[model samples]
Target: MKYPVLFSPIKIGTMEVRNRYVVPPMATGLARADGSPTEGHVAYWAARAKGGYGLLIVEAAAIDPLGKGSPWDEPGIWDDKFIPAWKKVTEEVHKYGAKIAIQLHHAGRQTTHDKIGGQPVAPSPIPCPVEREMPRELTTEEVYDLIEKFGDAARRARDAGFDAVEVHGAHGYLIAQFMSPYSNKRVDEFGGDFMGRMKFPVEIVKNIRRKVGNGYPIIFRLSGDERVPGGRDINDSRLVARVMEEAGVDAIHVSAGVYASTQYIIAPAAVPPGFNVYASEQIKKVVNIPVIAVGRINDPLLAEDILESGKADSVALGRESLADPELPNKVAAGLTEEISPCIGCMQACAGYLFDSTKSNISCLVNPFTGREGELKVEKAEKSKNVMVVGGGPGGLEAAWVAAKRGHKVTLYEKENVLGGQYRIGAIPPTKQDILKAIRYYITMGKKYGVEYKMGVEVTDDLIMKENPDVVILATGGVPLVPNIKGIDNPKFAKAVDILEGKKEAGTNVLIVGGGMVGVETADFLGEHYHNVTIVEMLPEIAKDEQAAVKFFLMERLNKYGVKAITNATVREFLDDGVVYEKGGKEEKLTGFDTIVLAMGAKAYNPLEEKIKGKVSEVYVIGDAIEPRKTLEAIEEAARVAVKI
Candidate 1:
């Protein structure tokens, strides 16, 4: 009722979505090694459906197993054997009155030889700038085979009871490779002119229509702008929309970016929200069919506004859905504040997909993302007195869930604010979204009856006086103070203090440590017209940061005239500047200003050693266990909370 247009039913060909909330297909890497749908994958989609999403466009399925997109295992529709397993997902989604669609995809040259078990195949023998591996050019007959494969996948999807099928002609995949001049340079019919390049997808669409008949919805996911030189631009995107319409496709779901423009694909917090809506609007001008605008449409009000202004017919929530599956239901119920916001950290959703250690899709804020069935907060059989130390994300999550499960939970924080270092970390540019997660924790804590004791240091005496059944020490971390010459000087301040606005730097600032904190500190200072230089002992700065997020951050820092000297060791801190050694020579960089230290953090567990053995049930989490990102912190705390 609040967002009438956003909540309104809309038709995509023969299928009617219950609402305009579309969960766009995001790669979860949830399928088996053989490319079959797993129970976890089915549960992941079912949770979103039950949460009140109108339609779910499942993550890209390989039409050919050899065309697998990412190195991670993904679903496949190349074989008939996958149909029955996929049907479980559709049946579960349909039970909640939500229609589901499958995305037919191929990696093309976007992947590496190790991923697809060969030199990767594309319309042309072009190597993706990011992947750097030259792909084998597809033969004329092979191209025709792939077209039929797309048709076969669509027919299988319909047999599996899916309401629709999406041709993933976006994100620099196989279809996108054929459509773009950047990669397509063949002398064959599939390349050369715009229409020739368009012929591949056009024929694929026509083939799908012939196989699925005229009734089933066929949505073509188009990348409005590839964001790379000589790639598919908005002009080409509009023409593709018009041609796809003529080819009998039902809708256009416009996303942006290629493999090179990875920033736009996931759109980190640095990128403005709903920035790609302009592309969708441009394509919508040339097409009568529906156009769904995606890329960073996080807020529900923004989705409503986009629809109200006629910029897009439907709004897609990709990573936002992972952060909170119940977002649509919460918005429909007018409890917008309760909706868990995606901070766009890329710490989990995009982070996991790219990280070699992590293969499944998850969220930094919401641990229940890919593990939907695993991380449920069930009511306890017996209630107990739970005392949680520290008010950070991990501690807040632990206390909130414990209270929700009928435990009498009391949380204590040394600082008055609850978010701890994460809250302070939000001070940098494009990082203010981090506070949303912290605020959500605080809000949910109140809703779940969590008692808070602010600025109260829980000591051993206090713990003994009010003995709790369980004690969770999430005391967080202290800034790392490495043993360097003249390191104990009273003149320099920590990066945390600078972020907290407790300390102001001079015009010229020298920062020690070139990790995320150090780089962001430089950006924070550079924004205020300060000349900043970072010295790191490592080969690069912020090497641990998410690649795409780091790319944009580095770009902003460069604009601010921030200088970084890598493989340099800071030997001594003086009143004027720091003495550093680079290339085996000691050099003194003279500067008339503040000597700030952004030397990362170390685990602060002073109380853990003292109280661990004393408390019958004691657990330490978050930075107290080891200084890390919010991803590990929240997960560690949740794992402990469920057990308690």
Candidate 2:
């Protein structure tokens, strides 16, 4: 009753999904180098199925060796040997009463030559704007052959016992390449007019229909709006949807953006929730088959609203489900508070996917996401009294986990409220979701019987008084103000002070440092101040930021007209402006009414040294150990707490 529409069953072709929730395909990179599912992949999907998702669409599997999106470690269905591995995944998902689907994919020009053992193939010789890897145009004969390859992948999926299959036609892949005027400039029959561009995907659907038959469900994932100029928009997607439905497709999974606009694909906190619903609504009007809306549809209540408004038939959860596998179950049981919300940080999920060194997907808040089988919280052998210092994310997570493991926990915070510096981090209008993690931690802490002592600073005396078996110091960090002339002037303020509204900026602002904090502060100040300039010693701004996030942040900076000066070192702070050296040349940038110090933070671990020998066991985490990201803080806390 809490979310009737979201919990209700829906039929796609002959298949009946128990709810309107669909886990759209997300690349996990948890497969073997040869593109077979590893035990990690099997356990990952099985966990989601057991958590009560209705329909689970597995990550994209390359249809052929040349179609791989990544160089390695992506599942593939090109060979019969891979069928048994996929069958195990399907069987595991079915055991929990969930229908599973496999996405048959071809990366097209999105891939590199090193990935596919040769030049990547596409509708034309044009390359991706982002990747910039030129692809050879698929020959007319090869185009038809690729369509048959798609059919072959679907037949293998059926033999593997999958309930459905989805064609990966979106996000500037091969099919989308043919559809977009920006990517496909071929004058051949495969590309020219709208219908000509539509020729390849249409033939693909028909071929897949022939292989899977009319009974088996077939979903086509489409980018409702490519979000790039001259690319396919919702209107074009509406036509494609109608064509696919007429071609016997069972459903349409609507997503947005291309590689050039990758931020919209796996949007961060800057993008609002339900970002793709409007496009889905437009596409739904032209098609009879079910339409699934995706992109930052994180909350169950939001999902319900989208369904009740008649925007789409189903709501697909990608990263939200990764944050909490049991999200649907919690919603159905009216235990929504227990569900861990995805903060849209993108640090662990999309950040890792984009990192070639760490391609495995995980969640920032939930450490057990990708390592489902290995990292489990088991009860401690003996319950111990635990004293936790600070009330930030790390301390709260440690306390919650320790309490769940049958430990007596008491968390102390110097401030009246919890969340530590995270409170200030959430002050930005776009970053309000950061506070949701703190709220979830507090809620779960209370449920697990963790005691809280607010306005109580945990000094050495306090720890000795408590005399707990274990002491965890998450004392957090302090703003680092460089020792420079005139730095103590009233015009200079810390970034946190400005964010928290403790200090006000003038018409012109100069922010020192160009890391994530500095760039974000520049974004915040740029909105109010007419002139905002950020100076950093590094060659680039937001060097530590994830690629997709950095891309969007830079776009916002450009939009706001904020001037960024990198490779500049501050020599001194003057009353009106700052003196800096760039490329070994001294320069004076005047006319700044206010200066903000966003130079980052230093660890506040005095208590760790104070209570080191006083406690039987001592641990330092979060900013208390060293100022880092929320992902590192929460993960370190959980890893240490579970062992205790």
Model 1 misplaced regions, further than 4 Å: none
Model 1 lDDT, residue 398, Cα: 95
> 220-255, model 1: which lDDT tens digit per residue?
998999999999899989999999999999999999
Pick the TM-score winner.
1
Q: Pick by lDDT: which candidate is best?
A: 1
TM-score of the candidate numbered 1? Answer: 0.99
lDDT of 2 by residue, 43-104 (tens): 99999999889999998899889989864477899888888998999999999999999998
Q: What is the TM-score of each candidate against the true structure?
A: 0.99, 0.96
Q: For candidate 1, give the lDDT of residue 234.
A: 96
Q: Please report the TM-score between candidate 2 and the true structure.
A: 0.96
